[model samples]
Target: MKIYNTLSGRKEEFAPADGKTVKMYVCGVTPYAPAHVGHAMSYTFFDAVRRYLEFLGYSVVHVQNFTDIDDKIIERAARAEVDPAKLAERYIAEFYDEMDSLNIRRASLYPRATEELPTIVDMIQGLIDKGYAYPANGDVYFRVRKKDGYGSLARRTLEGMLAGARIEPSSHKEHPMDFALWKGAKKGEPEWPSPWGPGRPGWHIECSAMCHHHLGETIDIHGGGQDLIFPHHENEIAQSESYTGAKPFVRFWMHNGLVQLGEEKMSKSLGILVTVKDALQKFSPDALRLFFLSSYYRSPLKFSEESVEAAERGAQRLRSAASIEGQGTGPDLDSDPYRRRFVEAMDDDFNTPQAIAALFDLARQVNRAFDEGRRFDEAQSTLRELAEVLGLTLRGLESGTQADIAPFVDLLVEMRGELRKAKQFELADSIRARLQALGVTVEDTAQGGRWRKG
Candidate 1:
């Protein structure tokens, strides 16, 4: 299979470091607040990477980390009058709820920064002992000058980085380019006892330590948002290789494109953000997932209500087609066109757009079979396998909601219709409010109102 390697800036054939076993690590969240659509776009991209590898019959071991102790966590905790650790825990639970609603597969190991303090401190001390890092006033900083080929990932020189001031000046560092390995404990912040003094791991060091601890010194894939390609991933390569003496810290580096809001990055600081919980209230979770898959993983995804609505319409078409060919018997093991098309698309750098197009192709065949009054067992099975590869569900292409909410929504819809026909606008609005309160949404259309589960 061909996968894009961010370090090389080219698509390369993928081969597991160990035979038939793939180990991957992607950066997780700091958990200060509710996750937004941008966060959804980030994790959803990596989840596709893991799912596709497993679909190829490789034993995949995926690990993601929780940055439980950070400045954001501490600051937010102080404002909320709760412990920083408790704040992290609450948001971590919310993260899982968001991921589960979107059908993300859980990672093999979900390591938290607090739980891996020993590993982090040991790694930091190794850097210090080897002369690659130094202690300055209870803080440890990596000596960027000591590591040769330091800017290979960012393709930058120390001179250029300094000129650009990407490497900001630090009074205590041996050089301005050097980054912190361990941060000194501050008032009202979490800390661990370390050789350098009681302190916390730097942002970059936490990821390197966590990745090495979970996936080893060398692993098949290391991935995160494209923003990490610079100081974050570059510094990771330097410290990890210097400590382990490994040639390459990660064999293949995969970076998903940035999530964009017009010309700007989506940010809570700017107030132009939508929370996952709120967005899911207006649209199906599958719609957002499909919107992400519609673009190549390595391309910028622009967010706007109109664009999201467009994605929703396209996803509805695909889901509608699959529902038409509900449950059926298995297909013949051979001569499965859907299987061939999907594998071919995935093999070519995980081109999901092509794979989705193939689904429509199969939808045509299923439609023809339905018109002929023929059993579509083969077509049905093909749709199931292919959709699984794409991490999508047809949800009974030809069926209705089977959950307990189905009956409740059906009753509410009838009541809403009667109230509307009576021209009791106030009563109809009240019924709609009641349905929404029950986590059921009612939508009015030319054909009248219909309700769906929240």
Candidate 2:
């Protein structure tokens, strides 16, 4: 299979370095708040990659790390008046719920930064001993110049990066581009005892340390959002390769483009994002997955109601095609060509848009064959199998029977009524709006709020 390597800046044939299991490490979320659709988009792409790799008969050991302790986590925890650990735990649980609801496969291991502190400190000390890092005040900074080809991943020299970068000068840092390995403890923040004073791991180093401790010194794939190309991923290459003495820390670097909202990229820091929980209330798991896959993984996808609504309709079409029980006793519909088309599209750097087009074409033929009194059972099965490779569970409209979701909808309607009685009109209205957006109409009678699926 051909996959795009961001480091190489081109598509390359994919094969496991060990010629067996694929060790994939994806950068997980910093669980300061609930995950947004942008998070869904990133993970969904990686999940599809993993699913496809496994479908090709290669076992994939995927490890995704949680930035459980970071500046954002500490700050959000402080504002919420809770311990950082507790705050991260809350959001981590929420993350699992939303991801599971979206039908994303769980990673093999989810190592948290706080839990991997010992490995982090050990790696930091190794870098310092190798003259690749130095202790500054109570912090340790990676020497950007010590590593040859420092900016190879990002394809820029240290000098070129500094020209356009706005780096804050620090007295302890030897160079402005030097990134921290271990940060010094502040007055109010989580701290861990390290060779350098009590402090937590820096943003970039946590990922390196996690990869080393979980996946090993070198991994097959290191994937994350494109925004992390510089500084974050570049520094990972330098420190990881420096400490492990491995030429390449990651064999393939896969990055997905950001999800955009109006004009700006959907970001937690910018507070311009729609939460996955809120989105799930308004769209099915199949619809969300189809919407994300409609665009190429490397292309920035604009999140819009119209696009998602259209995807929902497309998903319904696939569902109808797949559920068709053919009664014809004639010859079976030829599905090998559609399967070949899917494999070809996927082989060309996981061209999912083309693969999906193949599925729709196959679905169209299945519908036509069903009408023509020809056997279509195998074609329906083929459609379902290929869709599963993309993590699309064509399990009816909303992933379950109305009876299965009725209790949850009823519970939400009841909660909305309670919110209205408590004078939380805004929250109540929001629930109503979200339910309406999901095609459920709520009627407010003198008795209470009643809901019916449209």
Question: Clashing residue pairs, candidate 1?
Answer: 323-396, 323-397, 323-398, 324-397
Those runs of model 2 whose alpha carbons end farther than 4 Å from true positions after fitting are 398-454
Q: Model 1 TM-score?
A: 0.86
What C-alpha lDDT do the candidate models reach, one value each? 0.82, 0.91
Q: Across residues 54-109, which tens digit of lDDT does each residue of candidate 2 receive?
A: 98999999999999988888888888799999999999999998999899999999
Candidate 1 has its poorest 10 consecutive residues by lDDT at: 326-335
- Candidate 1 lDDT, tens digit per residue, 47-100? 887888988889899999998988888888999999999999999999999898
Tell me the spans in candidate 1 whose CA falls farther than 4 Å from its real position.
325-335, 396-454
Candidate with the greatest TM-score versus the true structure: 2
Assess the local accuracy of residue 309 in candidate 1 as a C-alpha lDDT between 0 and 100: 81
The candidate that wins on lDDT is: 2
The lDDT, on a scale of 0 to 1, for candidate 1 is: 0.82
